[model samples]
Target chain A: MLTYEPDETVAHALDPRAKLAFQVAFAVAAISRPALAPLGVLSLLALGVLLSANLSPPRVLFGYRYPFGILCLSVLIAAVTIGPPWIDLADGVRTAHAAYGVGLVLLVSAAYVRSTPVRHSRAAIQSLVPGTPGRLLGIGVSLVFRFVPVLRRDIGTIRDAMAARLGTERSATERAVVLSSRGLTRAFVRADRLSVALQARCFAWNPTLPPLSFARADGLVLLLSVVLVTVPLW
Target chain B: MSTDHEYDSVALVPESIVRPFARAALLAALTGAVAFVSIPIPFSPAPLTLQVLFVFLAGLYLGPVWGSVSLLLYLTAGGAGAPIFAGGHAGIGHLFGKTGGFLWSYPIAAFVIGALVHGRTGFGFGSIDPTADETPSGGFFDSLEVRDPATVGLGRLVVALSVGTLIVYAIGAGYAMWLLSLSPVEAVAQFVAPFVIGEVLKMAATIALVRDGRYELS
Candidate 1:
């Protein structure tokens, strides 16, 4: 689940913390108290937020096709299985509303964070958490982004090694075994080697923390967030 | 928490003050990457992925504290907008979505798996071992620890993996029902039933690695 892709969108212009808060408020509003008009408004509002951030509505919907599709299928199944030879209207509405909520969440979240840098996320995290715990957390998140590509490559290598050793005719289960074993062993060994590298560099926690500077726009977003939260409660 | 002479990962790996934290960060990353290895099923929304393997492995290798610590880091990273969740999805949105229950349970599940691996505490019902001991069979913080997993009887590994899978499903499917407003049968159909065979296969694969003595990370 990697989303951050560099872009000069309006969402990207806001502080990472503000984006985080906006997404949180939006999700909370969606799940905590879901209703008809409010959900529709939230949906429109999410679309507006995405558009303002330079994301296309159709594109976001297309991106969410997988989950939305399954949600539709399940609702249909429920209607068919439990209904008396027909679709149940109430069940259908309820499921549709829930699916809407889910879709809104995925779209807004993907749009907001997809444009930001992994470093910005690290900075946002550091800002929320303070002192030693935050410091450690910031570093760990950095490592996750750093290694995702490395691990992806390692997985590819594992697949290649498996094909070479076990031949292509092996079952998916056999491939998974070798892939997991070899891939994880490589990851762990690399982790240990990282420790050695840390020792070699004499790394310390006092290394410069990622810089996070909140802006006036962020304050406005937070103020707007109050209304966002209140709407669901209202 | 204790930086003692025991095989605390921090002391032995890099020998430093903040190295444990570094290792924790690395483990979280590893878990995130493991999450990306998703295999979609034709029928169920929940896919067959190796996510649980790593989560349990995190517990097996990182011990209770660090294993839980790494999972916490993973949630934070994903929550803060990293695409660390399944299907490369990100943000706190997942924390409240259909899969929210599963995402929320990861840390607790990992901690349980790790604790059982260490025999530090009982998860529920029966303890990890019928006759409990202060220290577990071998190694501190193992991904099915090299020595112990390689040597331990198959029954014990099955018990450990079974307990871990059940914990994940209980919270995962429970929340899935509540969050998604599905009936009990529907919830089970979506979250548990489809994944049963795949989960078992993944578990068997992990155990096969253990039995084959391929456990490398000490």
Candidate 2:
């Protein structure tokens, strides 16, 4: 999985806010300029981002196989003509260019994902948006990150137990109902227990979060992001 | 442990908000976990996923406000790189990619489903008023109000889920068309048509799950 890993790479040292800005800027540049030349330059920058994060392009590509597959399929569908000329090469090329743009954007994000931790991301959000909304989002996001693995295990157990009993032979609706109901039941149970724990621990609205500061390198990254954001205008 | 610290200084999250928030977060996590559970359809390239089924349940169970909040948390967590998007793909990039439209529509769809199922009169837009009309079954915590989803009828659940499904497809197909520059017919054929069977199955599954009386949110 492409998640945060402890590393001393340059991308890892920068502020999460700077990285997030770069992602948004990169996405804007990729989406706005879909032509070959700009995309090629953006592709190199994206690859550079991956290399800086100590990530390989192929690993990221493998993680994105599903979206890539869909993009390829769309390209094929766009190329085939119903009648007359068998294939519209131009149409296929256009779709491919758009897909390539999306792929580049994905690559840039993969770098971000590999380099940044969830706590840093949460701190960035809490600081970016002030007051109650930010607090809710910051805490809620962490809660989700904590519980996804737990709930995933619960669902996996449900599936396994059902399989052991010959539940697969049941109709789709029955199996779905069985799985979902059981899944939901366990989730609520966990929620109830967790709520008690939070109350006991005095879950505060203003807890001390891990500090995030903009280092010297972050200034450079933000400047690069600003430059990327201006590409479409030029 | 630290009685010397000023107890009055800390502003604690109230029991009322804590319970629902925890439920919302868990439901969002459930939605993410289910994304990995893909069942293949014969001809279509994309397999059937139970993500939308949970979307419906989020609405039915959490109601309009918190249900939408749950989905919003899902989106944020996924964007922050939780490896929870379809097929374990995660990043801010997916939020702007071809399928971004469907992903962006989740909160709205949940809100719509919750409004329809709960039979709320107004648009309810972002309101977190759990005390509106539905009587809260006061638990041990005086502020905690638990509303049973079973109170809603089966027909309402079906209609609500159907409308939610339509919203997903409309936004998904429309966005895909604009992004990929596909004709309307082509977009529908490619994006919407293949998933009809899976969608129907999901709707049926959601309805069945909702009607089952064995489980209720505490």
> Which stretches in model 2 have alpha-carbon errors above 4 Å?
B1-8, B40-46, B121-147, B216-218
Residue pairs in collision within model 2? none
Candidate 2 lDDT tens digits, A122-169 = 999998878767888999999989988989999999999998999877
Please write out the lDDT profile of model 1 over residues A62-118, one tens digit for every residue: 766666676776676555555465767676566667767877887888777666777
Give the best candidate by TM-score.
Answer: 2
Q: For model 2 chain A, where is the 10-residue window of minimal lDDT?
A: A31-40
Residue B209 lDDT in model 1?
75
Backbone clash pairs for candidate 1 read: A1-B83, A1-B88, B60-B142, B61-B141, B61-B142, B61-B143, B63-B141
lDDT of 1 by residue, B1-218 (tens): 23242332221222422344556666677667766565554455455687777777766666566677788888887876666677766777677777778877878877776666667331223222211323333323221322254655777778877888888898988986776667788788877887887788778877887687555655
